[model samples]
Target chain A: MTNKHNPAALNTGRRPLRGAGINLFYLPAILILIVFTVWPLLSGIQLSFTNWDGYSPTKAFVGLSNYLTMFKDHNFGTVLVNTLIYGVGSTAIQQVIGLGLALLLNSRIKGRNIMRAIIYLPALVSAVIMGTMYYFVFQYQQGALNTLMVSLGLPRVVWFDKPAVSVAIIVIINSLQYVGTSMIIYLAGLQGMDHSVIEAADLDGAHGWKKFRNITLPLLMPAFSTSVVLNLIGGLKLFDVIQVLTGGGPGYSTNSVSTYIGLTYFSNQNAGYASAMGVVLFVIIAIATTLLNKGLDRLGWES
Target chain B: MTSAIRHAEAASRSTDTTGKGNGKGGRRIGHALAYLFLGAMIVAQLLPFWLALSAASKPSTDMSSTLVPRLHDIAWDNFTTAITQGGILTAVGNSVIVTVCSTVLVCICGAAAAYPLARRKTRGNKLVSAGIMSLMMVPPLSILVPLYTLMVNTGGVNTRWGIVLVTVAGNLPLAIFLYTAFIKAVPESIDEAGMIDGASRFMIFIRLILPLLKPVTATVVIMTSVGVWNEYALSNYLISDPGKQLIAPRVASFFAMQSSNLGVGAASALIAALPIVIVYLFLQRYFIAGIAAGAEK
Candidate 1:
């Protein structure tokens, strides 16, 4: 309601027809979005109801059949469960580890900058490289891990043979690789905290665990929420690591929805069915993200 | 002001009493434990890179050895063979073209679009912002099939430009969101001053605004480049020609061709990763800042 002049806004008195010209700036962007994003999204929804092999022109419209087929598929069920576990587990691990690292690095440490750089190296590397590196590390015979285990007088475990363990390892590797980003976020939050409040707590004998729990943790909720949402979204959409490391294999144990969709669309050449799966995945993500955003709002994150 | 004085007093008191009793011993033990944990974590993180570097340097025959490679048997030929026989050079070139072009285009278009959204208080601003936000939530696979079909129909499939354009499009929402956030942080006063000096809007953006946005620009460039270079899924489906494939798809195909050449494959993979690793090492601060900004928003 304040009538303060905003220089960015056009002067209506001098430029009465500015609105029409101003609207022109939006055309190129809107056109690109429609062509590249919105149209494809709408087309994908349409394709979900049809029975179209990727190549053939002839198609049959099948309502909800593809969705029904996905429901009945055992692999789909397993993959859904896997995606949830991976999402929750990775988010938890990454947040905790990243928070700890951020706190440690926040304090005075020797060569902190160098350590920060080294820790962040993995995130910058392509998922393919990270997966390949892990593949060698988890190789059955000549793996570095097996060698280390042998030296430590522990049994050489075949990582990929067991489904759950293989999936967990993949999640751990991916989470660790990305922890640096979360750590940086937490570091920023820490930097922005009111230092005076922390000092007051210190004066009241809030030291160590008490100080951390009462002062540090509560103030760091924004970072926690952000990290949690990001890690969850990332975990659900995980593809590159799984693709390179196991190819959704050791018998589809590590398969995610993204990988499944890729296999169905590209390898199986069932575009319509894949589109249906994609829609389902999209709905799930949208719902989860909405819930999270609501929760964050309640926690005053938007402020 | 009182808090600062209190903090100083507390620090002095703590230091004055630091040499008391068995607390020093306890603190030393705690420090040792912290160092021990940190060292182990560092080793865990660095071990893979160490292994890759050592293995790449070792002769092919020595690759299967249980022991770590000796410094003497470093097979420098692996680098040459990786480029020549492994066909990594062409893949590297393809990756460079795709990453560089996509990143530049995304940055330009994203910034241009973001300027209006960030600066103007128009009727559709909120709607536009929400639309872009929702676009970020849409899973990549949801539109993959349709996009592929569209590309094939439009004669965009199997071309470098095709890959670049798609990557740019896919990345637009996030890029615009980040750019809007960054541009908002720059005050409108600068624009007013430029206008008072009789500068055009485009001139103001290019001269005043763009220079100040170097940090965000570096962050976006690094992120987008790494993403484009390492992307396997899009390249796998789009580029059928092996010669035109980027580094990731090339690695996948190379591994498929000769599983026994794990050493060479690993080496080639390392070679592909080196540029990003180098960039990350130099611009790590900006990378972290960009991520922190994105997450915070």
Candidate 2:
């Protein structure tokens, strides 16, 4: 029945279904994107220059005042720094731990499948819930840590008393929750590797650490980039965990730009300033993503 | 492949023959250390959930360490209270509606969008594709203020369809990227065959391409469902009404209100996490594969 369709045999040839009409298939998606994402993004930029208090209909054009105010705002500086720390700290830690776990599980370990499942479990759970669960370890009253301290006849230590300590806890929790993502990525990369190359290197007296550094490490570059970028973006946009754990408390000391924006808009009612901060966050992520991609591409080329 | 394995086995055998005596003790110590490290990591990873379980089972008056489990006096009321007072079931229902609606829209729109982009490489289509892909990098919070305003003006705030549209838009970029990649791999000859059969482009897409999209659709569905189900940033503000709020925001708010009642808080958190955990356990293979595929984009 299929052979009966020989219309193309008489003609020179028919190209692979090329037409302007088919482009309409993307219309629905493009319309949704335009309305929901692109339009909002553009309007956010426009709102950055206004002095709207998020509720009032009337607004005055404030020019670059919002952007200028952001520069002088000491709290914004702290939030920006925290954002970077969360992004870089989590990315670095996740790579080390994720790769280590992946390597360990890849080896001939007992019950590795279960281990993999367990390690990856939290990555699937909502970060808000994970943060609440982890709060048990650091909660002030009857916390796991405080309970142990009292049992050992020590003073009750406040876990989130200081800003730095709180920030560090957030980083660790975020990293631990999502390290499974990186581990799975690297595991896939390792499994898909050209084992023949490893075998050849092995035949040439390359063993263990030497083999891993020269052969395996370079081969895992693609996975490294994917995991790093994903983790980095996730960390930079860290919201739920911080919201649940501290709610950007301690006088905004632990706020990332994300949490700061929410506070500014909802709590502070500084919609214009929050919009400016949103623009800044977007620009920062854009620059970071571009620079990291370029750097990774160079590394890939060199290796 | 067989020969590669044979060579790998032979290579290991040779390494064993040459370095057996010198490295035997060191290898044993290394294995032991590896196991120790992994065991400790396993504990660290499981500690939170274990403690949550313990806390949920204990009474609110039990201010003992969450590390301690109540073997005899289990607080059954905590779970019931979370379900009844915490509005967890309502939140779960809200999440289900939003997640299902968003996932379906994403899969349909994404697959439809990818067909033309993958088939026709027109300059306009290429630019459109790039533009759509770039939206993936625009963090949702970055556009929250204006999006919230838009939702309010349009009466989309506190509505299930509103949240669904926003989530679908947020997730469609990645879904379209994945679907486009998958469809590009599918032989163009298939489309040509449909064309030769005098089938319309839509007919070819509906009849031929859609069936082959099953695997990628699974990846998209899993990704979008998990994302929308657990979404906090957008949904937190967009659906501020308690009845319409999704799981993450609802649970967070409930936990905050019940902060003193650790038992109820723990129960609510566990209830929110249970559905995803059960799904993951049952479809462990697909979850891992879906995430891996998502990351590849």
Worst 10 residues of 1 chain A by lDDT: A12-21
- Compared with the real two-chain complex, what DockQ does model 2 have? 0.54
For candidate 2, write residues B123-161 as lDDT tens digits.
988999999988888988899899999999999999988
**lDDT by residue for model 1 (B81-182), tens:** 788887888998999989989999888887877777778766688688779778877777778899889889999888988898878877778788888889
**Residue ranges of candidate 1 with Cα displaced over 4 Å:** A1-20, A152-156, A300-303, B1-30, B63-67, B192-208
Q: State the interface C-alpha RMSD of candidate 1.
A: 4.6
Which candidate wins on DockQ? 2
* lDDT per residue as tens, model 1, A117-182: 776778777777777776678876667888888779998888888888888898888887888878
- By summed lDDT, the worst window of 10 consecutive residues in model 2 chain B runs over B13-22
